[model samples]
Target: MEIKLVKAIPGDVLLLHDVQTRAFQPLLEKYLDYEKNPANEPINRLFEKIQYSSFFKMVVDQKCVGGIRIVARNNSYWISPIFVLPEFQGKGIAQQAICQVEEIFTKHNIWELQTILEEQGNCYLYEKLGYERTDFEQVVNDRMTLVGYRKIKN
Candidate 1:
């Protein structure tokens, strides 16, 4: 399958919103109030928040299949809400998206990457890509766990 990472377009916001909500539905259902009331946040609000991020990227074939948002803080880049459509999972869409985002971060001399995940498999993916666990954990929603990771280099 052909894949390309591109700067997000205005029209792509709604698509990303759908992908994120679906891709993360299982996890969010157990941990977020928004899951109880999906109707609350306007799609435009989601778009605006993503648009304001310094590092926002999307992967597309004919349309957005996955995306990632990053923010720079304290010399480290924080990756949030990386998601691939449920139908596209295990097709390497997420791995490619992460690599593309990391390339941009590296070009800016941002060598450290940070993220939090709730699953061991997610942690394994990051570990295989050279991320180290800082042994930090936080409980959100009183029912879900967040495990933090940091990568110092490519």
Candidate 2:
């Protein structure tokens, strides 16, 4: 399948909102009350992310299938949310999209992100792409575990 990562424009905000809502429903079910999740936020907040972060649309076969939001802080880039629609998963879309994003941020030496502990696919995908699990672990409301990952350019 053809895949492309395009910088999000103002008109794409609502589309991204729908994708996030659809893509993250499973995670929400798994983590229940994942209050910090961008998917759990409102569409207006996504509009804000568009202004403040490097947001992208994952297009596959000429159709928007997923999205990613990365925020740069100091020397590292943080991926707030990288998601692919449930139907288009297992096709390496997220990896391809992330690789495309990495190409644009070559000056950054490190990339970091977090995923819920129970989401094995999300964790494994990052690890397979060379990210290592850092020592940091965050507990949310004493209910769920969030694992942090980091990848340093070598």
Candidate 3:
């Protein structure tokens, strides 16, 4: 469906914020009692960080279907907060964004990549995508847990 990765622009801040809010709403309510607080520090941090990080939004058919945040650290790249709209799920949009990141990582000589998945199904998805789960931690206030995964760049 014509997927492509476009670098984040100043104009995309609000769109990214909307996508982040929509994609995480259910999970936040279920796991963290989060009620879409607009003044959330984490969201603010995401916006501030995006200005200097390798951020990209996945566009499909001229619409922003998904997005990813990749940061360079210690000579490796770590991807986080990859999100695809609920309606767009199961269509390989997340995978395409990740694969694009892998290509960039490899091109730039990045030797490792890591991310955290807070759901079991998502953990399996990461495993299927070649990420090896290293450890998991249970969140004290919720039934959910966090899983960490890493992949050595090829």
TM-score to true structure, per model: 0.78, 0.93, 0.82
Give residue 79's error in model 1 in angstroms: 0.8
- Model 1 segments more than 4 A misplaced: 30-42, 54-57, 107-118
Off by over 4 Å in 3: 33-43, 107-118, 136-140
Clashes in predicted model 2: 0
lDDT of 1 by residue, 13-72 (tens): 777777767777765565564643232447887677667875344555467776677777
The deviation in Å at residue 55 for candidate 1 is 5.3
lDDT of 3 by residue, 44-112 (tens): 666776798988988998898777888787766777667777788778888778877887766445423
Q: Which ten residues in a row have the lowest lDDT in candidate 2?
A: 30-39
- Highest lDDT scorer: 2
Q: Give the clashing pairs for model 1.
A: none
Q: Candidate 2's C-alpha lDDT?
A: 0.86
